[model samples]
Target: MGEDIGLWGVPLAIIGGAIRVSTPFLFVSLGECLTERSGRINLGLEGTLVFGAMSAYAIAYETGSPWLGVLAAMIAGTIFGLLHGWICSLPKVNDIAIGIALMLFGMGLAFFFGKSFIQPVAPDLPAISFGFWSDYPQVQAALKVNILFLIGIAASLGLWWMLRNTKIGLRIRVVGDSTDAARAMGLRPNVVKLLSTAAGGAFAGVGGAYLSLYYPGSWNEGISSGQGLMAVALVIFARWNPIYCFWAALLFGGAGALGPALQSVGVTQGYYLFYAAPYVLTLVVMIFTSSAAKTMTGAPAELSITK
Candidate 1:
């Protein structure tokens, strides 16, 4: 009976873990998708994410409101995005280089200021119970869903619809395809890229907030664990589609949860190696999808990686 329960527990744990782990990925990838759709890449989102986490944690601790912390994170992310966009718009500036620099800068700021927040307790985001009908404690715990995850799902659908139907989406698509064409059509490419990057940063910031204010709920320097960087690969795997990003995030999340899920079932041999599953999957996806011979399918025409 115990073995049977363990077997059943494994799948349930993975399912629950996927939902919990995927929230940040979902937000970051969705943000990256939006930024790329406008023909700009902001690699500095890693920094933005860390800084946002710090900011969210600090604010939540001080204000006693997790929602305010989220708002602060968004604002901070927007500022970082604006800075990245502005710098990239200058003559002879490289967007990729700017992104890397900003990544370092953001992380530095986060570490320096976040030191004080390490020991403080902050208000956590609330979770909605979806397992009310279940009598099992494990099931109930597994089904306790965060509001941010649900919001991410809605954002995915909304982003997909906007990209397919709206005028702003049309502009983003046009800009991403060709700056020359965008200029010919009387659109300001720089402005579009600027706003898109800012928006993307905002999304990433929210992802960071989800990290410290919810799952793994704490303010810490290492909380991100390179998830922000991995989100870039996720965008590639999703082919810049917001809907696909949602699924891809969940896949990555499930992979991340594999180790813990197995451990719970008494499979401890090589347990630590399971933690590498997400990274391994990232590398595999990159290897198969990347090619020097041709542009990736669905990649933005003007994207630096594609070009």
Candidate 2:
């Protein structure tokens, strides 16, 4: 470890850390992008993310299968989305308020039910090594990429493509841009938003799976560190573009890795401050994207926040 830390430490750690940390951001933002495109905001996704982590870890511990745990998390997230959607569809309900309530509820439930999983050993997901091409052990370890990360990349690209070309994507965009137009076209805006929100929740659940089943590789209440909420801001910064979300995830991941990367390079002092890198980046993004006119340039017309 000491030998590897001399000159290559920060870069190597950043590379490895970026891959590990960016994954959840990638997933959550993508999920939020999908939901927002349908004109609903599921702030409850934070709760969905936490609940998914608890469910994933617990199920993985009990079933001895990490993938099964991931599936369970997805299902749980979908349920949360369904509930949020149902409530939001009712007259005069606030999606933002509903999201906050669900976030607290999910956190409470995760802490209550995840007690047994605190000490249990859950299975880990697989990784593909690109480090074999290198001779160093640390290099090999650092270059070992989690399969889920790769899947996130694929999902980002696929989502971007679908939004530009697919029929389902067109419907979602239409509902987002104008409810009246959708109704005129004989499309059900509520149904579209509901299903999109559910899909968003499922993606967040997979992100939770990546948390426990891969990096950090354990079940814990504080594992998410507000990634789900931060993702909402990330989606905004990316202008609700799925392709941009991918790049934004990478940038956030690199910020998150800054502290550890510096520590690895013998910069032990104030290392803890680096953990705030992502949050700092988030603040900066929000500031630059904010407008004095109280307008969101790229936002969908039907979104309550934009109105």
Query: What tens digits encode model 1's per-residue C-alpha lDDT throughout 30-105?
Result: 9999999998888999999999999999999999999999999999999999999999999999889999999999
Displacement of the residue 199 alpha carbon in candidate 2, Å: 0.2
- Go through the candidates in order and give each one's C-alpha lDDT: 0.93, 0.90
Please report how far candidate 1 places residue 245 from its true position, in Å. 0.2
**What is the clash count of model 1?**
0
Tens digit of per-residue lDDT, candidate 2, span 81-196: 88888899999999999999998998899999998889989999999999999888768877899999999999999999998899999999999999999999999999999999
TM-scores, each model vs. reference = 0.97, 0.97
* Model 1, residue 214: C-alpha shift (Å): 0.7
- Runs with alpha carbons beyond 4 Å of true place in candidate 2: 293-295
Superposed on all Cα atoms, model 2 deviates from the true structure by an RMSD in Å of: 1.3
